[model samples]
Target: MKKSYCPIDTFINVVKGKRKATIILHLFQGDKRYNELAKLLPDISERMLTKQLKELEEDGIIDRKAYPEVPPRVEYSLTDLGKEIHPYLKGMFRGGILFEKRIDESL
Candidate 1:
């Protein structure tokens, strides 16, 4: 199948969005519950977080599992592919930090 523009850019777009990568980083530790993620990412709204998580799961970057119980339970974890792309995400974060450092130094 033919792809539009740079495939690499498209791949990045899939996982890149406001607070999305940070969510992924948190998941890198292990599977996390809905409340756990919300607690970890307090800056993000519940609606936005829900949307981003659904998108990530759709993109195969993460998996959502629910267990039948009284209170209900759901957990999110990085799919194998998410782990594979995490190194690249780490590099991106490092580069961003460098850029911020450079700007601060110049100022």
Candidate 2:
């Protein structure tokens, strides 16, 4: 398939999944274990969660660290690139809240 022509399309491609944005937002709070993430997004199915995490990791938006221990442990955190996008996400969030409020008032 052809690559995206627009910059926003490229960004959207990286975080296209339903849970991807929420995952990134949660990681903004702090690094989280696999189970922790699952807990944070209780509505997501395990299969879907695994898929989105893999996509994020492949896109270099998140880092996955596995610890060598009795019980395998995995943690996910944002990369430098991911951190760089935080301000943009925050801006989108504020705008979204205002947009929602406006819609509510209009209804």
Q: TM-score: which candidate is best? A: 1
lDDT of 2 by residue, 1-107 (tens): 12599988887777768688889999999999999999999999999999999988988889999999879999999999888888887787799899999999999
Count clashes in each candidate, considering only residues at least 3 apart in sequence or on different chains: 0, 0
Looking at model 2, residue 56 earns an lDDT score of: 88
Q: Which regions of candidate 2 deviate over 4 angstroms?
A: 1-3
lDDT, residue 70, candidate 1: 77
lDDT of 1 at 54: 95
Best by lDDT: 1
**Candidate 1 wrong stretches, greater than 4 Å:** 1-3
lDDT of 1: 0.90
TM-score of 1: 0.91
